[model samples]
Target: MELKEITDHPSYPDAYWAAGDEVFQLMDPLDAKRTLRLRANLNHNLLLHRRLFLADTSILVSPSMFALLHDEELGPGYRQLFRDGSIVTAMRSAANNFSEVAALIIEKRNFVAEMEEDQIWASARLLDSLSPEIVRTDTRDEMLKIGHDYVLRAEYWAALGIPENVALAMTESVRRKREERNLDTVRQSEFWEYARDDLLTPGEAGTAQQIRAYMSIASLGTMAKGIGIPPIYPAAYGPNVDRIYGTHTPWEHRADRRMKLLEPFDQKDPRRLDEERNIHEIAALLTADQVSKIRDKVEHRKLLKGAQQAIQESGNSAAEILERALEEFRGYLEVGAGEFLVDWEGGGRRSLLWETKTGQLMRQFSSGAVGTAAMIPGVGPALGTALTLFGWRRAAKLEKWREGFREVTQEAINDPTIIPELRTDEVIELSLFGEIPYSFMALGGDAEEQD
Candidate 1:
């Protein structure tokens, strides 16, 4: 298809596709194939994922930006960034420290240590859900290494807008979308937050244009790394390192430190890599609101399983289950995250009527998750006692309680006036150990049963 004819999604534009088209159209097929080869042995420091590499390779040229920062393979192509005013201005603006955070990002130092404390912690928090700490020290070193590499490469991409000519050729829609998307940039870190604001602010001289240029470069870099290519390392490994060990001389100390930090991660391990990929996949499926609302993995998993079972038991079709469950939890679901710990603690045939009359008891019942509780016998004292006595008792009798809880919950869900305190649109951070520390594990009568 012609470049202008390509408009895959709002995020991906015609100009970007056109650029890829041009690169492929002009290149010699054999040479292109050779350039795209994964030289892991030669580029050991780079991050390479086969799928991302293959996908990006099919779209554009590799080894161009890859070799730009590789000291050993420094070529004339690397100088092209300097010639581009848009890239230079954007990089200068983004790299506020000039010699600190910016330097570390593009250097091999990223694999060794974090560039900023705030950003690292933020990243760690974001990653905690995916790669949970099995042990006290299960810091997910490998995952963090890859994340740092990705962030650093994002910087380089922002600088060059890989395929400079194509970025320069962006359509109006693509350019406008880029500006809008830039606002979603995580503002947790001050540097990035300010950089985004400065670039986007009105009256800033070519800041937005420069950012768009960088975004174009960043997109190409993402495609490269998405498939399997590793992030690029700058040729000049900081002036401090050079001062300690002359410019021509090797920094064995720095190399040793980098090796020490990276020792925890083994990129060669396919299982670990797959696990990491799965983490991303899971994160994608869950919203930030949902992830944040989860109290703990144990509880979340239990609730999730219970929801699936509840949906299945409800006799609803697979297609209708999601809609039904969503309807059931509508107002009860936490804002932004769309999570609602189903509250059936006070569930019983009469509980809903009682809650409707005595708001205090209803408030108490509203606490705790609904998933598993929905199945529990939230019946009257006699039936609850009977179920406790007869362990094999079917949950069919609890349908009344389920209905009662649903009735009351539906009111609150539909009208926030019922429980104004619980209804809010705030978004909070996901819990590392969100499990409620306190729970009603038993319902009394245990002594009689033991006796």
Candidate 2:
């Protein structure tokens, strides 16, 4: 017997025959419209599932949601899902998504610390919940090796329309540039005065990079000590620090300070630096008498202490002072030496918030040092320290990416066709196989049955 005839008059069980018959019907021209509609629905379901899965994962790992999962009144439903292994599935999905995103960022060398802040908090919570034995296990290391292998084979640079070699070289160039900047900053810093001979007695070709990393931590320690704040080392330091220091100075104020200090060192555009240089050159053209007369006409500008003074004047307790000082130091690393600038007799500072090109460069160098230190094994755990050191410009990039995800989720929610109503025929067909279509379940079909 021919295949069509056998399928049409099969002696198989009813369930098997029903599945085969559905496939045959799908292939028939008489059922063409239904087949196309089914295909469209399948595509829509896949798209919707992807969007929902991502959103669910984000919410699940969010700090707010993680805290809510402990609530007595509202925790039972989520706890039940955990017991049934749904939460595990969601967490695994989140891990995979994070790994992929991390691989892309590593390949592109566009490290955005704030974008991973939520995930880092989630991972910290998981570690905190685990037993000591589980925490000591090498499962995370093994998983990271697996992720590294997958990234190597995936060739993520291909997606960026660049060759792997070029992408790698670009990453290397950025690393080299950062290292050089860190070295320069260390040499210029007060810490460098004490540690120069130790660092410069180079034993290896990459000694500078090693020293740069060390300087980052040493500088942090020095800064903390200078402010009379004892260093606190928690397994997950970032979120804890944020909660403690958040009340002292707003992130907006810190960000504004960072921008003012680092704006002249912007690598993407050299116009600002050039414009400043031109102004200095024009000043040099003026005679000494003329420059002295112009300086006399300018208003005297006193250095603004701002947050530093506010923290000191708050009259808080010892512990409170330490916390505020740590927060202040965090801001200082971001702005560098410009955090304390003085007006000179020869130069009339016109701007109320005056930071020279030299000051901006110093800020960049200091940032490089602190950022390098944050990557060390145990030094910088606080999120605020890492975020401040890494630069606030990345926050803008993160917001843009988040807005795109929000738009996609909104579009999916608004589209009626993406999750169509289940018809009786479809329900009966799916039920024959001892299964219910997800669309039906999603549309509250299982709720009534459960009750």
Candidate 3:
């Protein structure tokens, strides 16, 4: 490739090129030649390196905009948060509850209009005396209002990982490209081809690939490429233009460090093999229908292994496991006492029930309640909700509580108040439930045996 092909882009950073020379010098010439160039915006470079097996000589660049924005303290550094798997999570949430979002948009428009009228009336006496300046003043006020609205919207988008400046730039870039190519009327496949082959530079192409791999969305599907929706949506989906305009923040670097801290507990941890083997055997013995219900529950492999180990060591009978799972499933039906709390009960659940999901209860829990969490079996909404509780506890640094909750829940299954309905592999159901019990909290528990 020509030097210009690598260095000509506005997104290309000077430090990246400077760093490249040092990295390249350390590489064997043949390996350097074979190295593939992969550029990502912000801290996504770390993700590319860790996930894609990128060579040291491979050119990795961040947008120059990120470098410029660093002075503002809201630049690429903040952008790294997007790569922390939070943005994608937020967007998925928004997409899942689009109807509620649409309703909110309508409500906000009306609220804004009402506020503007009140403000205008409050300033009417001052406006009446200066008629000539009123026009200019009113126009300026309107522009300021517009700017403020845009900023708020931009912040909302940024929280979903799309920075405002990057979003705007992507909009302009897509508009320019579509007009230049006259791709407005192009078919989906043809537009996708153009987007992949012509619209993006090499760095952008690499970024787009990363976004696709990361998002798991390879194409726009039946969605056409056009100048509609400010063009940025297509560009973001196609060439990853948003990432091309930002950089990573210090916060993102810290997040990466935290992620690294969790690496030692990964699948290869020697202490987890026995538990994993038990889980595997249990999984093989589970009913196919039961397996499908808990598919989304166990995201953390290490955590799941630990939960399995807890259950295996408990020496509980298969009938006891079934009873515990059934009781937990029943708990989910008790609306007010369900497994999910307000903030924890996310997704579409928030819209369905409000009385049981009071903000006060969640606030108390978040403020430091030694809340209960459990590992129980059975299909239905309860399993996912239980897992969500466990996730919140883990995120909140309630490691002891989490382990205790798990142990307590496991023991709770043996309560005579509830009847065991289903008989499946105890380990499989317990694995799906995925929580460690707090045995010490129960009456006959050993205080010294802590997780």
Candidate 4:
């Protein structure tokens, strides 16, 4: 562990992604060698990388002053000396490593996005396992614990005392974790089940957290629509209107563009409302990562049927199978929205909402969404549309409004509600965020009521 005595691993050259003219040194009085040596670098983005170290790397950033070749999100990519030239990237190995680390960081901070959270964490863990000896001293547990949020508070949690920027990066990683969690609660029902023992982060978060997460996502379609666009006006019967005209706010435009990605769905942007839409988007991607494979055409329905059959044939409590299957199937279900009724750990019964990928995959099969989609060609899109956020859009009046409302409804599903069962009508009304305004949705429900 001592600097001089601990020679570089034979696999790599002694020279590494260092930042400055001289090697950076850390005095560790506690250690017998009492010294730590690392490559240091300076970043020109003075405002962002003010600490003369890697604070936060954007996906597009590069490393300078001899830094790791990680992407902007990780810190830096690679650096080259061109006198006054500022470095934009780092070494290939560093870049790859940083990218993995970046994913790990995102996994935890953005808790609502379960899918990507799973994928990124899996990827990060894969990288760590594959390249264990590369950076033997590097702290990878944090990355490993990313998807399972709340691990920062775990008793084993330890900080490696890296550079200030790296330290802060790690710190913010945790801050963002809890912040996003709280953000989830802020948007939905309060009593949502916390992830169970076999299924939670170190944070001790409960069911309310999940409900909030579901609602947060289900609402995204509308939030996306409303976020960066201006208000819109229906193409009225005034002049021969070629295109529908709506005065979109900056947020509205953003939401509008995103919604255009999917047809026949309402787009509501959460940006202007400052509802943390970016987090929502990222969470959606992470959610994709978590259960995307289950959502994939291959397993969605097959597994669901298997689980149902298993429950029926075994004559066992369907609770075990159904409860666990909720995770994957929840997204596939157009059942409006779901809540964490109970937890599997912390002395509570397992949640029927199934938070695991296996469970989710089972739900998809049992729920009839995938099999039906496979059985009939055209029915896939229609089935998906109905089961997704648009569970109530058909009943609405206007064509644009109905489709748009559908978009809004879907986004809200990801974010769970704090209160117990809510009427679908109320949730739909809430989904009309951008199109109809909160006042309309707010009118039906009691603001003070908390279940």
Error of 2 at 35 (Å): 81
Q: Which 10 consecutive positions of candidate 2 have the poorest summed lDDT?
A: 424-433
Q: For residues 344-433, could you state the per-residue lDDT of candidate 2 as single tens digits?
A: 222324221223252232122111011100211111111112222112222223445335434433443343221011110100111000
TM-score, each model? 0.18, 0.18, 0.20, 0.18
After superposition, candidate 1 runs with Cα above 4 Å error: 1-166, 169-319, 329-451
Which candidate number has the best lDDT? 2
Candidate closer to the true structure by lDDT (higher is better), 2 or 4 = 2
Q: List clash counts for every candidate, in order.
A: 25, 3, 13, 121
RMSD per model, one decimal: 27.5, 31.8, 27.4, 23.8
Residue 320 lDDT in model 4?
A: 29
lDDT of 3 by residue, 1-451 (tens): 0011111211100011111221111212222111211111212222111111111111111112212223243333323332222111111112122233233334333111212333333232221222110000012232223223332233422433443464455434544554665643222222233234543665354333332221221111101011010000111111122122111000001211110112111222222222222232222222222332233343222233333343343212322332344334223323322333233334223322212233221121111111112222321113211221111212213455344444534444443211121112221111111111111111122122211
Q: Clashing pairs in model 2?
A: 237-382, 238-382, 238-383
Better of 2 and 3 by TM-score: 3
Pick out the ten consecutive residues of candidate 4 with the lowest summed lDDT.
237-246
Per-residue lDDT tens digits for candidate 1, residues 1-451, read 0011111221100011112211222222333222222221112111110111111121112333232223243322222221221011111112222233233343322221212444433332322212211101111332233323432233332332222332233222333443565532311122223234444445432333333222223333333222222222111111111111111111111211220101111223223222222222222223223333332334434433434443233322321332333333322222322222223232322234323442232322122111101112232211111111101123223566445434433432343111121111110001010111111111111111100
TM accuracy, model 1: 0.18
lDDT of each: 0.23, 0.24, 0.23, 0.23
Ordering by TM-score:
3, 1, 4, 2
